[model samples]
Target: MPSPTHDALRTPAWTPPAGNTKPPLSSRMMRAAWRGLPARRYDVGWEPGLVVPAPDGSPLITDHYFPRAAGDFPTLLVRSPYGRGVPWSPMYGLLFAEQGFHVILQSCRGTGGSGGRFGLWRNEAADGRATVSWLREQPWFDGTLGTIGASYLGYVQWALAMDPPPELKAMVVQVGLHDPHAFFHANGALNLENALVSGVGMAYQHQGLAPMVKATLRLQRRLREITTARPLRGAQASVVGDVPWLDDAMTHADADDPHWLGTSMGQAAERLDVPTGLITGWHDALLDQTLEQYGRLRRAGCDTALLVGPWTHTSAFQRGWPEVFAESLAWLRAHLCDDPSGLRPTRVRVHTGGDESWRDLDDWPSSPAVTSWFPAPDGQLLQQAPTDAEPLASFRYDPADPTPSVGGPLLSRGAGPRDNGALEAREDVLTFTGPPLTEPVDVLGPVSARLSVSTDTGYADVFARLCDVDAQGRSTNVCDGLVRLRTTGQAPTRVTVPMSSTAHRFAAGHRIRWQISGGAHPRYARNPGTGASPVDATEFLPVRITVHADSELTLPRGAAGTVKDRGQPRS
Candidate 1:
């Protein structure tokens, strides 16, 4: 009998085969972004240090710029904590310049020669609103405005969108978080490690030339170490929990807190009436935040368009994804530059790996996209629904012997789409497999779960991964999610894990699999079974978890979906 591990590429998604790459650019590769696209130099006015008063009149500084002959060029303002001069995407200097945008990159207060104290997103909308007021007063001003960027830059974009100015026309938000409270403290659990790392980066970044100089020397030394083939592994420990994060995630985890609630994008999406384009990677750790924001934007009929790809937190910066930049330019053109091709899609567009095509869908999933459950006997997964009523399955979540991270939407480092091969049989994981499918299936939107369980330790977490198991037995973790087990059975534990909304085909003979465990660390801080204080609470909760198929994962399924967009599934 042939083992079920002979042909894993059973139904490979749109990922170009293993060795394909972008056609070489006519431009230089990987050297530097300084050699940017040509910028039509129009004299831009910089009235440095003109203070824009905050809501209560707190002094805030802003920088304004536009085309020399700008009769009504849309204003593109990016109020970022990062310095204005050090181009985030060096190509933007050229890209936007050529696109006829008045890109104004201003360092937020307490950053890059700006005035006033910096208070993260808490003060973003006010500052952004103030800046817009300043821009309108400019000689070359266009009443319409749009902004763009990722992460922090994207965060501010959402903030501004919450209470947009009349001139605030549109935006492009990439990998931005939905709720800062949840981002800092995931699922009510504080991530001290992540908080520390960010805090350290901020402390170093805010330091003037002195620390920067020393950091440069250290980087050079690290570079030397790299060239010498010496690895600097686990250096992140030094910078974890480095800022006011303890207060953000620890002291402010409560949903009622003004600060925490104010940061949520759900509320913002409700008020944002302008057209928006959102792009994010499926494998990103912050995917939930972006996904939640997308759902709200669409549901609110906010004229928002969403695009998710098989990417990581920084997938946009990687080599194989220049198409994203082109798409982004189009998005901006539609919403910002008013171009025809930049028009928003009829529905969501996703790059499904298994199906190997871009899929356009009507609304997210209105029905069960694919229905299958884990056959629990002795850990070996049966890629089909469970007929026999097994009461429970078990796995040991040992923090010390963590499941080696795989490629997917995680923030930690990995080569490509992290394959979950190294973690399949860990005694601590509950694995389930589906028999080879005779037909193709389409999975869109959220992948939900309804598991029946009883735990002694007051708290537990369910980690579910939906993957494509090739004939060769390689289990590639396509998409997975986590939830607090305590919230199950007691209340509405109907948490929807962010699925990589794509059209994948588990061809005849290809298997579908799910790996259930306690955690996927680093990407998400491990949930110690104990619901003790997330910070300074070190005890693990031990509990009994029972998974019932009646309460199985609810997916947004559609049969071999019809092609509606340019990126249609390969029939």
Candidate 2:
């Protein structure tokens, strides 16, 4: 695995660091510096964006900024295709800039003020290299660097780190991708999170732009002509406008493609040498990817730290991230500035509900992590693990009814922070309960369900919810995950398979329940259970999918079980 050079990692170019506590510069100079330029006197004052030479004579270039105040200050680099001033860029500026560190926010080609067509992930390495090279030359740069951000911003950071820059000191990645394609197809099905991100980005891309022009741009003339005149003509075409490789990717969900292989952040971890800081929300749809990344880097002997919170993408965002932002700043100061003043850690700290307390740990998957099983008996998620003697819980999955989507982990325009109370009565869904624990159970880490399940047809869908059933019967969803069974890597006839992750603890008197069904429609496309292809194929089948719980869900029991599962106020 060849890595990009430390110099190449900071490509198209860099600018002087900005002065903190200084009065805001004129919008013209401010915008100019943001475009990777110094606020120097200009001839015509067009405010040229940063100009870094592309490795190849490709017309593509990047616009990046180095910190303003001083020479030789360590640098933090973030490359994103989204405009440089949006939340991705501003979020970092607010978080890292105040730490007395210089941060480089660069616009990827075809974005912000950079040049080039955008769509593929393969182009980042080259652009990242140009940005890094430019950062090293900046007079204010101390010649050391690190990378940080969430989602796409974080993806670019990871991509650059895999090919460490000589001065690439460290990284902090949140709920982003290691392998873009794998994230898109977690179980050989559609990557709901990726699809959502793509859609939201398109919506945000033109938010404040001219209304008429934005509306016109939303109409894809090329899309209507190229693959097909009408996207609705084929299922594959429908997802293309919003997905990275809509037509080709949807058609070959299970097929190994180059784009798929190249998206692997795990594979890239093999060549990694930088220390890393990881932050992920428990309810983040991409939380698993963050966990896998930290674990892989740790196993590879890279310095790594992790923090998992109850928040999801955009949920409890803004106000809540400063805590982790402070931690990242301290880490950079220690590693990049050689100032290890306050680095002692409480390790894994989780904010639990109920009492709103934080639990600390020495490590993630901390000591005393254990898993127990319960069977699905008479439609109840029985506490006893599964056995042949127990009758499996059965249900009919109707695509039309779609087991109405309740809140779990999501990142739509206005999702998360929802109560699952309304979904308890769907005929297609079943729930399991457990007696509350005598003592507080702090379960952190990824949760999985192991059970024997058989479907009436060739396909099935498993939706698991870990809720905090309060004394008053308010069932608040803490964390939940759904798996499309057809792509679950086993024979379709099997009765049980491992489902997705769940996070929540059963308070004494509260019961933990699992919902076995064929789908969580709208939130996710319902599996028809007919074994038809997911893309262009659409049909329905009533299948009796029984979850035999001799299988169990493995919860990440923290040393202190800091998982905060809270209850809603009773009506």
Candidate 3:
């Protein structure tokens, strides 16, 4: 057989085939949701278990693939904490290699076959730069490199790109956490459920128990028990054995602590100059961070494109969207192959949930209009801010019987958008509904609430959700947020909660709803109301929360006449 490195394997530059002039917002979803990867596109050659030395001489194992019909091609690199074979290899290594690109999948230090102690996000920067230097010395490497992957895999791309390597050309960053602190501390409270599960999962992964970790990742019932267990600090030991990092994370509640500064990629991300694409789901846990990353890159004059769908962190990887792969490849080609026509320098495409279609915008937050809704004493949501002091809406929050999590971006089973009817009916949760809308209201950006609340306990947590109430009174969540507060003084304090951004249309006759309460258990750690660390708080204090009537919820809306029926522009 001819050597796989033969000039014949050198394929012509790839170009995105021309499609509709005005492309559908979700052409990928419209196509059969891709199951697994399509059969290999080009004849491919794979070399497994190739070891490269890091600067410190620690070994990083990689699997390399190149088209059998081969010529030198721009290489695509995927550096992941996951093993470099099986799962990640098939999706990225083999799939991209067969598509006429040189692909390399390297296991990050301390996981897979790589040598070095795993320090989670802290180790990627140095390891990534070392891998790039190794790639440069490869016979097939053409000095052009592009990176792709989602979640942690995607995060490594940004972590390395913070100080862009000259060989690095573009990246497809999907659902990645930019701030290490945000993963543990969201809005000043421990994101207990996700942090514990994720930390445990990582511990198991390093121990070579990959199958077991995947099998139990979504154990919602077990996770609930773990989060609600007494002595929160030691609860995880019962789940995945001892993980010292979990204990440290719980104790260091402040995100700005110097210890966490080393892992933050946000500062480095601002200095990036590479062409980039961001892919995230409306209900993905990292939606907020993804959006924030895009804004930062765009402001820094980096070329960027954004695509958001109605999927979860796990589902997005399982169900491949055609546009996601096509556009991502196009993006890589444009920058890595000296071809810039594959995608516009800046474009935003978001899938509006209820309408179930895509809308292309010149920029994000296409909403030129901002709408504010206020809470009324009578369980009503009013368009105008209240002029009088209405009676406070009170709810008793007992950590022992804390509100269960139901949808809207979670790290576990009940993630994504789900009905809030069951949750809304709970006495601990206070629901405020608006009258039927005269016309459809298109909400397309960040959702936030400024709640004036007073609690009887010294400390408490406030969880808020933005939902759409249909004509039939069915409530489905759109976005939500939570914050831990100190309520010792008995004075009403304003807690500003920032929910994930969304692109959804509240149809005529549908009502806007805000479900406010003390906590979203397991999703966020239940506040013990004693100003103690969530992990060590075994004493539970029932908090009586009084939400002032004038508290406000804000939704970003499209400018009058900007949003059209079916998401198309109306002349």
Highest lDDT scorer: 3
Tell me, by TM-score, which candidate is best. 3
lDDT of 3: 0.76
lDDT of 2: 0.57
Task: Please list the C-alpha lDDT of all candidates, in the order they appear.
Answer: 0.57, 0.57, 0.76
Candidate 2 Cα misplacement greater than 4 A, ranges = 1-48, 58-71, 202-251, 353-355, 376-379, 385-390, 486-504, 561-571
The true-versus-predicted C-alpha distance at residue 391 of model 1, in Å, is 2.6
State the lDDT of candidate 2 residue by residue for 411-520, as single tens digits.
65434445566677767777776665577665655666665666666577777766677777777766666666653432234333334343344566666655555666
Q: What CA root-mean-square deviation does each model show from the true structure?
A: 12.7, 6.9, 6.8
Winner by TM-score between candidate 2 and candidate 1: 2
| Structural similarity to truth (TM-score) of each candidate | 0.78, 0.80, 0.89
Question: Could you arrange the candidates by TM-score from highest to lowest?
Answer: 3, 2, 1
